[model samples]
Target: MSSHAPPARTHLLIASLCLLGLLSTTGASLPYPILAPLFAGDVGNGLSAFLGLPPKLLLGIALMVNPLGLLIGSAVLGAVSDRLGRRRILLATAIGAAAGHALTAAALVAESYPLFLLARFVTGLLEGNGAIMRAMVVERVEGPLRNHALSWLNGAFHLGWLVGPLLAGFTVGVSITLPFTIAAGALLVGALLAASALERGTAAAKAGERWWRVARERHAFTLLRHAPLRTLFSVHFAYACGVAAFYEFFPLWLVDVGGYAVREIAFVNMGMCALMTGAALFAGRASSTEPRRRASIQAGLAALSILAVGFGSLGVGLAAIVLFGLPHAYYNATVQGWAADQFAGYGQGAVMGLLSTTFCLANIVMALAGGALALVDTRIVLVLGGALALWAALAMRNWSRRAVSVAAQAVELR
Candidate 1:
C-alpha cells in the first residue's frame, strides 16, 4: 500500500504529522505565560481567590497534574497505539485534546480551579499522540530520511513553543480565557488534518493477543531492564528533570524577580525558541557521529548549568536564557537520535512512550520541587536543577567510556 502512494501523498502525510506535533506542543504550552500571574491573584480578574489556596501550592498542583497525566497517557496510549494502530490513536487523542482545552477555557471563565486542573490533566492525557505520531513517522520513512523527518518534527515542537507563548500573551491582553479556546481550535484542526492525511500501518498485536496484555508487555518499566537502554533512559530523565524545572519556574522568576511583563516574557521565549530551532537544525546536520553527539550533549549540559547560575541581572539573565538554547537543542537532538538508534527494534511507539514517561516523571518532580523552593527562593531551584544536569553530564561521560571499553574488548575477542 505504501509503495503505490504518490510522492506528494507521502509528503502530505509527513507534513500533517509534523503539523500535529506542532499543534500538540502549542496547546500544551499555551497556559504557561499567564498561569503564574493568573493563579497568584495578580491577573485574570482575581481568579486565584476562588481556589482558596496559596498561589504557589495551587500552581504546583496544576503543573504537577499535567505531567501525571502525561506519564499515564504516554505509558497507556503509547502502548495501546501499538496494538490499535497509530492513526486511530492520533485521531482520538487529538479530538480529546481539543475537548480538554475547551473545558479548560470554560473553567477559566467560570473560575473553577478544580475544573481547570481536571481539564489540564485531560489535555495531557490525550496529548500522548506525540509517541504515536513519532511511530507513524518511523513507519513511513527509513534510513537518513527518517532522521531528517524526526528532526523536522522536533523543530515543529520548538516552533510551537515559540509561537504558543506569544499567542498567549496577545490573547491574555484581550481575554485570559481566549488562549485556551484558541488552542482548542488549533488542536481540532490538527485532528481533522490527521484524520484525512494519516495512513494506518501494521498493528503490533499478534493473533489472539489482548490489547491490555500487549500494553503491559511493552510498558516503560519493562524497557528499563535493559542495561544500555536503562543508562540512556537515566540520562534522559536527569536532563528532563533539569529542563522541566528551569522551564516551569523561569517565567515565575521573570515576573517576581526580573519584574517582566507577559509580553516581555513572550519576547524572551521567542528568542530562546529561535535559538533552539537553529540548534536543532545544526545538531541534525553536524552531530552525526556518536562521539560528536556525546560531546555535544556534555557541552550542552555544562553550558546549561552555567547559564542557570548566571541569572542575577535581568539583562544578563535573558541573554543567558537565549544562549542556553544552543545547548538545549544539541542535547535534545543528540540524545533523541541516540535513543532512536538504540531502540528502533522495540517498536517506535513503545520506545517513545517509555521516553515520554521518563520526561513526565521528571516534570512531576521538578514541578513540585520548584514550586516549594520558589517560596523560599527561586534561585535555589534553578541552582539545584543545574546541579542535576551537571551530574547527568558526568554520568553520561562515564557511561560512554564504559561502553567504548566493552566494544573494544568485543572487537579484540572477535
Candidate 2:
C-alpha cells in the first residue's frame, strides 16, 4: 500500500480524505438515532406532532427533504467542482455544511418544522461532495492503488455510519439537540483536516464546455436518456429503493414493534454498520459477475430479513438488522465499481453523480412510500422494499437483456 502510492502528498491526501469521510459521515449519520427517538420515541414530540400530522408521516417528510436536496446537489455540484476546483469546493462545502448543521440544531430548539426541513435541505446540498472525493482519488492516485485507496475511503464511510448513531444513542439523553451539536463539531474538525492536509490543486478543464455550461446541458437526470445506461440505472434504482426502505424505517420498526429504545436501536445499527465496514475492506476482491452477484446476494438477504423481522420476535428483528450489513457492503461496492468501470466514458464525475442521485432519489421515494405504509404497518413497508430488491436482483439478467434488445430495435428504427 505504501510503496505503490506517491511519496508524501498523495499519502497525506488519502489519509486526510479517509479521516474526513469518517468524521463527515459521523456528522451526517448522527441524526439517525436521534430521529427515531425525537420523532417517534413517544406517542409524539412537539415537532413530530406538528400540524397534527401522524408521527410517521412527519418523520417521512423530515427524512425526505434531506435526500431531495442531495438529489439536486449531486446533479449540479459536479459541475461546480469542475469550475471551482475540487479541493476548494470540498473545503468550502465541508465548512458550509457544518454551519448548516448548527442551523438544524437551532431549528430543533425552536421547534420550527419549516426551518428544520430547510436546514436539512441546505446541509444535504453542501454535503453533496461524494463526487468531489471520487474525483480527487482518480486524479491523485494512479493504477491499482486507486482501488486500494477507494476501499480504505469507503471503509471510513462505513465506520462513520457505525459511529454516528452509536454516539447519538449514548448522548441524546443529555439533550435532544446535543447529538446534532456534536455532529456539527465533528464536521468542523473534518473541514479543518481537509483544509490543512489537502493540496490546493485545480483540475484541468477536460472539455471545451465550461462547468456551468456542462451543468446546464448534462447532469444526473440526463443520464437516464442514454440507452446503455438505462439498464444500469434501473437496476441501481431498485437496489437503492430496497436499502432506503430498510434504512429509513428500521429504527421505527425497532422502537414501535420491538420495544427498543433509541440506544438499543443504535446498537442494532452499530452491529450492522460494523459488519458493513468489515465487508467493505474485502469487497473489492474477486467475485463472478460481481455486480449482479452482489446485488443478488443482497436481495436474498433482504428478503430473508423481511421474514425475520416481520414474523419473528424482536430478537429476530435485531438479528436481521445487524446481518444486513454483510451483503449491503458487497452490493454497494460492486455496483459502484461496476458503474465506474463500465461507464467511465460517460465521465467519471457524471457516473459517480448518477450513482449518488439514484441513491438519493430512492431514499426520497421510499421515505414517502414507507411513511404511508407505516401508517398501516411498518412491516408492510419492509416487505415492499424487499419486493423491489428481489425484482432488481432476481430479474436482473432478463431485464438487462430485454433492455439491450429494445435499444437495438430503436437503433434499427432510427
Candidate 3:
C-alpha cells in the first residue's frame, strides 16, 4: 500500500458501511413481507389463540416496534458515535444488529412472540447504520463531494427499501427461517467488514460532550434556531409526517383491503421506490445547480402530488408518492449540506446526531397518530398525509423566501 492509501481505506470503509447500512435496514424490513404468512402459519395461528390477539395486531406490534427502536436508536447511537468514535460504535452496533437478526430468526423457528418482539426491537435500536454511514460520509469527505456523498447515501436508503423484499422473496419459497438467517448473516459480514476496513481515528479520544449533553451546546441549538434551519426543519418535518403515514399504512391497506398478496405489495412498493431512486438522481442535480430553486420546485411538486393522492387515483397516488419522495430526499440531503456549511467548525457526528434526534421525534409523533388514524379509515390516512405535504409546500415557499432574505442581511452586515 502507498503512503496515501490510508485515506483510500477510509473510502473503502465508508463504502462497506453504506452497503451494510443498506443490508441492515433491508433485513429489518424483510419481516414486513413475511408478516402475513407467519400470521397464517401454524406457529402464528397458535400464538394468536394463545395470546387471544388478531394476527394483524401482532404484525403491527412487531412492525411498529422497529421504527420506535429506530427513532430511539438513531438518536442514542448517533450521539454515541459522536463521543465514542464512529469505528467502535459502528462495529459494535453492526454486531448487535446481527444478533438481533439471529434472535429474530430463532424467534421464528421457535415461534416465540416475546423473543420475536425483543429481537425486532433490538434490531431497531441498532438501526444506527444509516445515520452513522451518512455521518461517516460527512466525516470522510469535504466540499461538493460531501454533498454528492450524502445524496448517494440517501439513495442507498431508498434502494434498500426497494430491494429488501425482493431479496426476502427468494427465501419465501424455501422457508421463512431462510430469509431471517440471511439477514443475520448479512449483518455478521457487515460487522466483520466494519472492523477490518475502517481506519483508526482519534475523534473518540478527545473527550467531548456526552451524547445527551450535546443538546445543550449553544452552537448546536443556534444552528437549530437559525432562520433557514428553522424553516427548513419545519417544512421537512411536516412533509415527513405525510411520508411516515404512507410508509406505515399503505402496504397494510393494500394487503388487508385490496386483497393483494404480501409479495405483490412488495413488488408495488419496489416500483414506487425505483421511481423514487430515479427522481432522487434528478433532484440531486437540481440541488447542486441551485438549492433554493430546487426546493421550490420540490415543494410545488409535493403540493401537486398530494392533491393527486387526495383524488384517490392509484396511478396518481403512485406518481405523487414518487414525486414527493424523490424531491424530499434531495431536499434533506441539501439541508444536511447547508448544515455542514453553517456549522463548519462543529463536529459533524454530533450535529447529525441532533438532526437525527429531531427527525426521530417528528417521526414518532406522526407514526403513533398515523397508526391510530388507520383504525378509522385508510382515506383519512391518505387525506392527512396529503394535507401534511400541502402544508409543507406552503412552508417551503416561505422558507426559501426567508432564506434569501437572511443571506441578504448577512451580506449587508458584512
Candidate 4:
C-alpha cells in the first residue's frame, strides 16, 4: 500500500467513496417505484398514453436501456480506466452522471419518452464508475480491511435501494419529476466529493502503451482462457441471472397480485434493505476462508430459491424479502472477495468491468423477459427465477467440489 495518510483523512476518503456508491444506486433506483404509475398512465397526466406505446412495452424498454448502456460503457470505459487511471475516470463519470440525471429530469417534465430514455442511457453509461470504485477500494486496502471495504460498498448499495424508493414514494406525490431532480443534485454533490477527496492510483497499463493495445490486451474475453477465472465468471453470471429476474419483477408482482401501494412497497423494501445492511456488516467480521465463503454462497442461492417460491403467499412473500437479505449480502461479498483475489495483479478496472458487464447483460435479459411474462402472469416469472437459482447452485456446488478434488490430487502427486 502507498504511504498512509493521516487517519482522519483516510477515514474521510473511505466515507466519501462509500457515499458515492450509495448515491449512485440511489439515482439508479429512483425511477423504479414510480415507473408503474408513470408508464401506466395512472400518474404524470397520462404520460404513458401520450408516448403512443404500450405501457408494459415502454416500461421494459426503459428498464432495458440503462443496462444496455452499462454493458457498452463498462466494457469500453473500464478498459480505458486501466490505461488512464481510476481517480480521473471516476471524477469524469461522476460529472457525466450528474448531467445525465438532470437531463432525465428535464425530459420527464417535458413529457418526452425518447429524451427520458436517452437520459437514462447516458446516465447508465457514466454509471460504470462503479467498476472503477471497486477497483479503487481493492487498490487502497489489504487483508481484512479490504473485506470490510467491500462489505461496506455492498451495504451502500442496499442502503441506496432503501432510501431511493422511500424518497421517491414521498416526493413523487408532490411532483412526478421531483425524484429525478433530487437525484441529479445528489450526484453533483458526489462528483464534488470525489474530486476533492479521491487520490490517484497507479495506472494498470504499461508506460507509453497505446490505448487500443491496452484495450486489446486486457479484453475480458481473454480471461476465459484461464480455467479458474472462467469458472468464477460462469458462476457469477449464473447467480446474477436469478438476482436480476427477482429485482426486475418483484415490485410489479407486489402491485399486481398483492395490491401494494408505492409507499407500502417502499416500506417492505426498507425491511429488505435493513436485512441486507446487517448481513453486509456481519460478513465483514465473518471468516474469509474459502470453504466458508463457498458454503455461504451456496446457502444463499438455496434460500433465494425458497424465497421465490414463497412469493405466492403475501405474509410469506414479505418474510421472504426480509430473509433473502442475508444470503444476498453474503453472496455479494464472497463473490467480490473472490474476484478481487483473481484480479490482484491484473487490471482491476478491466476485470471488474467484465463482471459488471455480466450483471448488466443479465439485467437486460431478465427485465425484458419479466416484463413479457408479467402480461401473462407475474408469478410465473418469480417461479422461473427460483428455478434458475436452484440450477445455478447445483452447478456451482459440483464445480467447486471438482476443483477441490483436483487440487487435493495434485498435492498428493507432488
Candidate 5:
C-alpha cells in the first residue's frame, strides 16, 4: 500500500496555531516592558504607600504572580491538553487569558494593585498556548517543515513581544487601561477562532483515559532520562532564570540609573525584538537539514550575548540588551525541536507539557530570585544573569555534538 500524504490543510492549521501562540505571548508580556512606569506613578504610588511598600516592591509583588501562575498552568493545563486534547485546552486557555486581560483593564480603571496582580496571575495560568501550539505544529508537520514551523513560532513569540510593549508604550500615558482592554479583545477572538478551526483527538490513543491517569504515566519521566532532553531542560531553566532576573531589573536601571524616557525604553526593547526575530527566522531555515550545526550556532550566539552583557563598558548595556535577545529565539526553537525529535513517534502533547512545566518552574524560581535581588542590587542581578547564560552555552555545546552525530547518521541512511 502506498503511504498517504498529509492533507493540504496541515500548513494552514500549523500557521493558525502560530498566530494563536503569538497572541498568547503578547497578552502575557504586555505588562512587563512598561510595568515600572505604569504602576510607579501617582495612582500606583498611593496604592504602594497604603500597602506599606516601595514602588519596585509593589511591582515585584504583581510580577511574581505571573510566573507563579505560569508554573502552575504549565504543569496542570499542559497535562490537561494531553487528556482533553489540544483544541479544548487551547480554547479554554484563550478564554481564561481573555478574562484575565479584561480584569486587568478593570483593575487599571480602579487602580487596585492587588486586583491587578490577581488578573496578571490568572492570565498567566493560561500560558500553555505556546506549548500546545508547538506540540500541534510539530505533530502535524513533517521533515523540514516541522523545524521551520517551530522556528517561525519562536519568531512569532518575539513579534508578540515586539508588538505588545511598543503598543503599551504608546497607550501608557493615554490610558494604561486601554492596552489591557485591547489585549482582552484580541485574545477573545483568538480563542473563538481556535475552537472553530483546530481539529481534536482524532488519533488520540487513550482518548477515554482520565487526565490524571495520563498525567502519571511513566513516559513523561522516561523522556527526561535522555541526555539531550536533560540538556534542553537545563538550558531552558538557566536562560529563563537569567533573562527574567535581568528584565526585572533592566528598566529600573534605565530610569534610576540611565535616565531614559519611556519612548527611549521602548526603542531599546525594539532592538531586542528585532535581533530575536531575525535570529529565529534564520535558525528555522537551517533546522531541518542541519539541526546540530544550528544548535551550535545558537549556543555560540547566546554565549557571546551573555558576555556582552557582563562586559560593563560604556554604552555596553544598550548593546548587550540587543545581543542578549538575539540568541534566545534560535535556542528556544532548536531545543524545542530537539525535544520533538526525541518523541518522534508518540505522545507529543505529553512530552511538550512536561518540558513546558520545567520552563515555567525555572521562570518561577528566577522571578522570585529577581524580586529578592532587586531589593538588594540590580547590578548584581545582571552579572548573575550573564553568568547563567554562559553556563547554558556550555551545556548546549555538548548537545550540539550529539545533534550533529544524529543528523549525520540520518543523512547517511538516506
Candidate 6:
C-alpha cells in the first residue's frame, strides 16, 4: 500500500480547506463595502469625525490600520503555527476573529472611533489564517496534488471576495453592522471545517521554547537575512507593487475616465472576480516548472502592463478589466507552489507567511503611491502600474541569470 491515505481523503481535505478559505475571506471582506459609506461623512459622523480629522483622511487611516495589522499577523502567525499544531492555532484564531467582528459590530453601534479601529485591527490580525491555510495545503498535499489543492483554495478566496461585498451591500440597509455579525457566524462555520481537516500534532522543533520567543526568532521576516531570499523578496515585492497599483486604481480609472458609477463598477468587479475564480480552478493544469512559472509570471506582468494602459477607455477598459483575471489566477497559484518548493527548508508556514506579508506591504505602499498619482491623473497611475510590471519582469530575468551562475559555482565547488 502507498504511504499516503486514499485519494478520496485528500479530496475531502482540500474541499474542507477551500470552504475554510471561502468562509474566512467572506468574513474578512464583509467590512469593505461598508467602509466607504461609513467614512464618507454621512451615516456615522461621530465615529468618522472623532479626532476632528477630515473624513477622507480618517477613511484612509481606517483602511490602512487593518492591513497593517494583517502584515504583522501574517509574519507572526504562520511561524507560530510551525511550532504549534495547525488545527489548534487556526481554531483559536478563527474563534478570536469572530469575536473581533463582534467587537466591530459593537463599536459601530456605539459610534466610537477608537473602538472601531481597534476592532478592525484585531479582525485583520486574526484574518492572517490565510497564511495557515496556504501552509497546510503545501505541507499536507504533496507532488502534483498540491497544485490542485492550492488552486481550489485560491478559487475559493476569489469567490469570497465576490460574495462578501454583495452580502454586505444587501445587509447594510437593514443595519450597518448586520453584515459583520453575519460574517462572524460564517467564520465559525469555517473554523469547524478546518478542525475536521487539519492534523493534530505539534512540531517537535524547539519543543519547550516560549511561543513569543519562537515567533520573535523564526518569523517570515527572518528569512530576509539570506541573500537568495532577499532577491526573491525583491522580485515578489516589485511584482506585487504592480498588482497592488492595478487593483487599487483600476476602479478609479473606470470612474474618472469611463464615467462609471458604484453599481457599474461593482458589475465589472463581479465579472472580473468570477473569471478569476474560474481561472484558478484551471491554473494548476497549466504545465509549470520553476523556470516556466517564472516565464509565465514575466509574461503575465507584461500583459498586465498593456491591460493597465488600455483600461482607461470605456470599451477596451471593460474587456481589460474582465480579462485580467485569467493570468492573475495562474500567477498567484504558481508563485505559491514555486515558493513552497524552493523554500521547504525554511518551513512552509514561514514561507507562506512571508508571501502574504509581502503582498500586504505592497498593497499599503501602492495605495499611498497610487493615491498621490491619481490626484494628477487616474490614467497616469494605471500607466505607472504597467511600467512597474515591466520592471518586475526585467528584474525576474536578471535574477534567473544570477541564480544559474550560483548553481554553476556550487557544482564547481562540489
Candidate 3 lDDT over residue span 314-402, tens digit each: 66565665566665666667667766566545456545655665666666776778768878777677678768867876766666677
Predictions in order: lDDT: 0.75, 0.76, 0.67, 0.74, 0.70, 0.80
Candidate 2 residues 336-388, lDDT tens each?
Answer: 67666677666666777788788888988898788889999988888788778
Most lDDT-accurate candidate: 6
Give residue 41's lDDT in candidate 1 (0 to 100): 59
TM-scores of the models, in the order given: 0.87, 0.81, 0.84, 0.88, 0.82, 0.92
RMSD of 4: 3.1
Return the candidate ranking by TM-score, descending. Answer: 6, 4, 1, 3, 5, 2
| Candidate 3 RMSD to the correct structure | 4.0
- Candidate 5 overall lDDT versus native: 0.70
Instruction: Give per-residue lDDT, candidate 5, residue 250.
Output: 70
Residue 398 displacement in candidate 1 (angstroms): 2.2
Candidate 4 overall Cα lDDT vs. reference? 0.74
Instruction: Give the clash total for candidate 4.
Output: 0
Which residue pairs does candidate 3 place in steric collision?
Answer: none
Stretches > 4 Å off in candidate 1: 1-7, 36-38, 42-59, 173-176, 204-217, 252-257, 286-288, 291-308, 311-315
Q: How does candidate 1 fare on TM-score?
A: 0.87
Q: In model 4, where do residues sit more than 4 Å from their true spots?
A: 1-9, 42-51, 204-222, 286-288, 291-312
